[model samples]
Target: MLDFTFTEEQEMIRESVREFAQKKIAPIALEMEKTRQIPEDIIKGMADLGLIAPTVSPEYGGQGFDAVTAGIIAEELARADVTGSIPVFYLVQASWGHIFDKYGTEEAKREVLPNVTKGKWFLGIATTESDAGSDVAGTRTTIRKEGDHYVVNGEKMYISGVREAYTRGGGHITIAKQNPELGTRGMTLFYLPLQSKGIIPTYVDDLGREGISTGGFTIDNVVIPKHYIIGEENRGFYIVHEGYEYARGLISVICAGAGLQSLERGKKYLKERKAFGQPLAKFEALQFRLAEHYTKLSFLRLGAYWALWTYDQEAKGKATRFEVSKAIAMAKMFASEWSNAAIDEVMQWQGAFGYTRECPDQAAWRAIRSFAWAEGSKEIMRVIVSRELLGKEYISYK
Candidate 1:
């Protein structure tokens, strides 16, 4: 009763993406993880192939693909290497690029998005502070009006691609308090460039996703042009939320892809690796475990597609925010947790080799582990579902 069908174009696109990722990305993926540097060549190649801005309109030098197509791209990229697909790149394009096209000033779009699509600039979001992750409205960062410009001063920690964007001539769509009295409602989003005076980046070493740098930015009275603001002043919260939803949606596909890849690797290993003159896969215990894991992954994949479809429908006025929110949160939760489980199961099949730092399995394991906490944590996703499904009356203070 269930259908898993792709259009001819979609099928060919998926195959093309898979082939490109494996042939061009896999060879140096391990090295990138070990060094935490995204090669300029890889970025340029993706740009040349028109893979950088899949969702942006062609007017801005993008492909203007639908959400499902974008999801397929994420899946294929993460299947080969999560780091190679590059979360920052996808998140920025899907979140910031589209948001700019929709809400930004014409001048801002002309100045920003074309460079983003050309791979000459890397775009990222700077919302999470050292104290504010899920609670973005509680952030302490402040932006004050100064004639035609705004002075931004605060520190954003655990930010991804700070150094890369700075070195590569891009910037983040930063969120900051626009009106202190308005609290959460009085914030604003700014397309703040890294080259701006007083903007500084400090990189951090992380345990996984070594190919991508995670760090923080310290703005010492950084000045941004007033024209850089996106949407109306003091309504930045909604803009940020919109961006978060898109990011969470695509990241779910990335997690699902990782799970699918892990399952494939495990099956191959079980078939070839033997113990006691028999294939380890011959054991009923292992076979049953893998079966259950695969079932969950299949469910997660379906849920991800359902969420994407719901989001698209909502964007077209065929659905509501509450419906889309629930679907997106549910998909993100299932995909992240189950993908980690699938990865762990695959790693177990490899025994000690999976734990070795040099092995691809180990690199993938660490990279996928980060997904459990990226975008919004699994706990946050649960809270979202609970709030929507149970409403205020069911929220427990007990």
Candidate 2:
């Protein structure tokens, strides 16, 4: 038997998040672009609603929700936030917070998850560097043990929430090579506090999602205690992918929500705006595009949920990692492309207004563009799908 409907609790969460996002987040979303930071009130509001890191356990001050429930919250946030800032903020914390709760030492969990779930701190994943984006094995960062502590030295670039974590008191679930000869097998994962000594922070002027800073930092021999290590030593390469898969699933849903919201605005505009003395909706060309986009996005939405469901299945020992990876890659591969296309068409429908900052879709277009490379690049997604279909001997990178 198959049930596509959401559970009662899931529906309630969607309604609650939708109401809060529409009433509280939408009005202030555009302002974040100018302010270059999410307002404190908005963070506090998310905290009150348990939207910050709901995947974490209740003992750690989270709602302890699963991946699908997290997607529901992310979808609503995307629907309300035209700029995509809030969705980025919510998804990263939720994804990495789940990782920390599951693998982090009890001491680290007590020290970190509480503040993150409360919105007083930020939790992010930082594996990308100037030299390595999708190639995790190419990471030049090094972490080596020194008696009771570990020392990390390297630089990470194009990371989200660096400034937020640095200023607001949190860190990234960072990966660094413990043995250069062992390659990916030598990697270790740990919580790297942005404010620690030997850490030098920098910033970049991004194209969109101004509310959340996108930049890098140089870690100069930063020392961390053993308790901050996530999972076992040299086992980070496997665990980090779990977090990436989680975030990728959420990104797929966010794209759908943003694309659909733009289509809604387009729908209203087409019905009311007149062209050649007739409503724009009367045009067959435009009507066809609208229907096609809606259909494609509807499939993307279904694929995203299916990927998340597969992840849950894997957790329950009902699915394999290869199965989950292939499913998630398929879902996310077309997410940014199709969503961006839909938003672009909506922008075109609005004439000159869509080109301006006043048009929400313009902001959405810029924000959604980042996801094509975020988490993992769309190219990498295709490679994963192919690798799964083919044997390991056919892997492109190997």
Candidate 3:
């Protein structure tokens, strides 16, 4: 039997987050979109609310909520501004920072996670390099063992929250090759601080998510303390996979929220719009399309929650990797593709007004459009589904 009722507390959480997002995030969303910067005050308020690390244990200075709570927050924040709601900030802390709490050395966790939870040190993953976007196994960053330290060299690209992670937050969990002979096995993860002398950030302007800097940098002989290494040496691949799975699930919720918010915008427009002496709502064609989108979005909502529930079960070590991966990928892939269509439909329903820069619809459109590319591309999600549907040995490649 399947049940999908939110407990009283969960409902309160959802309502509270929705209120905060509507008040704090919605007002500045358009300005942030135009200026390309999320306000520091807003980020601070989010941090104070423990929105940055809701699922992390309180021992680490977090709210210690469960996966469902985190998902609720994701949905509400995304509703306010898909690009500027600071969910990506939360995603980084939850996925990267939480992974460290689980697998990092005691000294590493003690030093980092507290600051991360407090929003003093922004945490992020620097796994995507210039040559290694989706092919994480092909990471070119190298970390050579030295006396009491590891010397690092290589470049990472498209890294989110670059400067802010350093100035406003902690740093990144970097994946570097520790053994050139071991292929993917040679890769090791490090909680490298940006303050490391040889690390440099060269900022590149991005189209959306303006407040957050997306850029690349070269690690020129930077040396990190050996204590910063996460998990076993040359065995961080699984941790990266775990982080990616969590990120995928969150992105699914983000996409779904974008879709729902677009629908809300459409609904408001329909009530205000009239044709042939009747409201746009009277047009059977547009009404029918809106109904279909609403139905699809409802399914996406359930799918997002189910995936989070499955993940919670996994966190307790009750579920298998295959189960977790399959659920998260299913929600992620469907939501990404569906959101594109949902937003497009809303735009068509609004006609010329939807295309205007002043409207929130354009922001929602651009913001959700990236989900089809980020986290994992639509093609990558399909590959995941195919691998699960077919036996691994029989799955097609390319």
Candidate 4:
């Protein structure tokens, strides 16, 4: 049986983050779309609270939070930021930073992680290419050894944090083919600084999450030193999945939080707005939707936290990697669909006011639409769950 009870310390962390997010992030949440960036003060405040990449070690300027603690922070940030920008910023760092901390060399960790945790630099993952999104094996980027360093050459599209990393003096943990003949085993992962010579950035407009840039970068023979490699060469394929699992776990929680927040807005509208005779809350139809949405979101919140707990258990040797992967995939499979359904229904209840950008739920709905494919596609999540349940021998691609 799953232990759903949170520790007192965890509850305290939740309360602190909830207060900070409601006060600081909620007010400026929509303003980010117009500014085209997160305010510097907001970033600094999150850094001061150790929220940027709290999963990293204290020695590297992070709080060394566990997976569940990180999920709590993600949930609170999602609830506060209807635009969903701040939560993305926090989760990318928390997920990938954990990987870099665990696998990066001492020199690299000392040089990079401190700035990332302090919000002085942005760290993200970049494995997707024009040809590859969820299909990691289709990635065409190439990394080759040259003397004392390595050279990477390829184009990556639909990546997050492109603008931040380029302007903020940081970069992404990128993946490339080090040996083509070995297939997935040939893949290698390394940090590629965005401002390096020969690197070019491209931008695209997203339907939501406007505060953070969603674009791509072309790595044209970008040179990196030996220490930048994450884990061992040729093991990047296996290693990157760990980071993706961490992110998916957080995304499930974020979906639940955003949905519940939208429902709250809907609830307020139902109680205050008059229908044909009385308040909308008195109607069985609208009230039934409200109850159904609340129930699904509540269960989603529970499932998301359960996945995070399973992730933490892997660290303690109480669970296997496959267990963590299955738990995360199952949690995420219906997360975005269910959340978006709830948000869409919430919008429907508000009549014309909900259709415009003036409505916060509109932003929440747009922001959540991406979660179906962000870390991994919803279809891919179903595949992961089925792969584990039916055994690897039954995997279609295999």
The clash count for each model shown is 0, 0, 8, 0
lDDT per model, in order? 0.81, 0.95, 0.81, 0.95
Candidate 1 residue lDDT tens string, 155-177: 89888778778888878888999
TM-score attained by model 1: 0.95
In candidate 4, which residue ranges exceed 4 Å CA deviation? none
Candidate 4 local distance difference test against the native: 0.95
After superposition, candidate 2 runs with Cα above 4 Å error: none
Against the true structure, candidate 3 has what lDDT? 0.81
TM-score of model 2 relative to the true fold?
Answer: 0.99
TM-score of each: 0.95, 0.99, 0.96, 0.99
- TM-score ranking of the models: 2, 4, 3, 1
Q: Over the full model, what C-alpha lDDT does candidate 1 score relative to the true structure?
A: 0.81
How many clashes (backbone atoms < 3 Å, residues ≥3 apart in a chain or on different chains) does model 3 have?
A: 8
> What are the per-residue Cα lDDT tens digits for candidate 3 across 1-398?
77789889989988988888899888888887666667877778887877877766787777777677788888888888756337676666776766777788888888888888777788888898877887788788899999998999999998887887767647888998988799878889888888778888888776666656777778999988888998989887778888888877888888888888889888888888988898998888888988999899889988988988898898799988888888988888878778878888888877787788876777777777767766667777777777888869966753
Off by over 4 Å in 1: 1-4, 82-88, 392-398
Quote the positional error of residue 244 for candidate 3 in Å: 0.7
Q: In candidate 3, which residue pairs get closer than 3 Å at backbone N, Cα or C atoms, i.e. clash?
A: 36-210, 36-211, 37-211, 38-211, 121-169, 121-170, 122-169, 122-170
